[model samples]
Target: MSTQGLERQTRNYLSNNVPQIQQHGGNFEIREVDEEAGQVTVAIGGACSGCGIAPMTMKAIEHRLPESVDGVSEVKVVRAGGPRAAVMPSKIDEMDEMEEYEDYDPPF
Candidate 1:
């Protein structure tokens, strides 16, 4: 298959697999797909951010992505809430302002 084809397939694979990842505790975003280098940069957010199992999650991606989608040789996960995760935030995180909700002190 062509590079473009591989990129498209990989993109779809990432999108489709997001739901499954979310079930694990967090979400994933495809930051970039390099067909030639056979690598994908994904931003992991929510509970998965600082979770210790995050590496296992990444390992699963690194192993399965290439097998499921051609041209994907590696999966790079960028944490979105961990110490390192602070460097990269998913689009959702970027759009959300947690501070706005902090003002709501509901007294039941």
Candidate 2:
């Protein structure tokens, strides 16, 4: 697929899944998509910023993204709170440096 097509597919996938993510008190922002590299960079924040299950969420994303969007090989995530590390295709980072979720209850 072309770079723009790949990017659009990824962004649309993310947008379509936003409600699911938000229901878990999380939000993902698509930072970029490197088509040549077949990678998607996502910023996850809100309640998911420092949650214990962030890695699980990332794992779910890692598994689902490729199925939802063609040509997507990996999903890289960044948290808003702190210790922002990229969650590569095979590994998830243990980022403990972040604010508690209570601080961002209402993100209006």
Candidate 3:
């Protein structure tokens, strides 16, 4: 798949899933996407930054965005930090955390 195709897919996926994201007062903007490499980077803006639901928004995007689109092995979110890098967490590290919690016995 070409980069353009991947970007298009990512856009479509966002549009289709925007409602869900918006319901939580969050939004995402595509920065760049590479199809062959299956990499996508997006920016989260608006109320998402200060929202306590930010984690949910991030988790939802990380889990659903790639599955919703083709040729996307992973998704990266970037918070608007001007010239500096985005404030989003590393995808690999986030995935590792998710995996760690996937199977567990809560000591409640």
Candidate 4:
């Protein structure tokens, strides 16, 4: 498939698959899609950035994304801003400040 075709496909895949990922509390963004080399780099973000299970989130994206794009050889992640990840949260420890709980009775 053409590179443009691949990019479109990749974008679509991300849009579609992201909700499934979010349901599990993982969030990510696509940083680069290299159709020539058949590689995709994703940046982990949101709660995923500080979660202890970040690797699991990365692996989940790596495993599923490639299969969606045509001619994808592999998924190359740059993490959230580390040597690998890009644009990582500046203060991972401060994430607790984001939590706000609302009690609700189940409709079911």
The top-ranked prediction according to TM-score is: 3
Candidate 1 lDDT score relative to the true structure:
0.62
In model 1, which range of ten residues has the least summed lDDT? Answer: 99-108
Q: Which stretches of candidate 2 lie over 4 Å from their true place?
A: 82-108
Worst 10 residues of 4 by lDDT: 99-108
TM-score of each: 0.57, 0.61, 0.65, 0.59
Clashes in each model (backbone N, CA, C under 3 Å)? 0, 0, 0, 9
* Segments in model 4 whose C-alpha atoms lie over 4 Å from true places: 20-27, 82-108
Q: Candidate 1 residues 62-89, lDDT tens each?
A: 6677889867788776666555342345
Q: How well is each residue in 6-103 modelled by candidate 4, as lDDT tens digits?
A: 77786677667656446655556677877778987777655566564455445565677777667777986534655433224555434333333112
Error of 4 at 82 (Å): 8.5
Q: Candidate 4, TM-score vs. the true structure? A: 0.59
Would you list the clashing residue pairs of candidate 2?
none
- Model 3: pairs clashing at backbone N, Cα or C within 3 Å: none
Clashing pairs in 1: none
In candidate 3, how many Å is residue 79 off? 2.0
lDDT of 4 at 47: 55
Q: Candidate 2 — worst ten consecutive residues by lDDT sum? A: 99-108
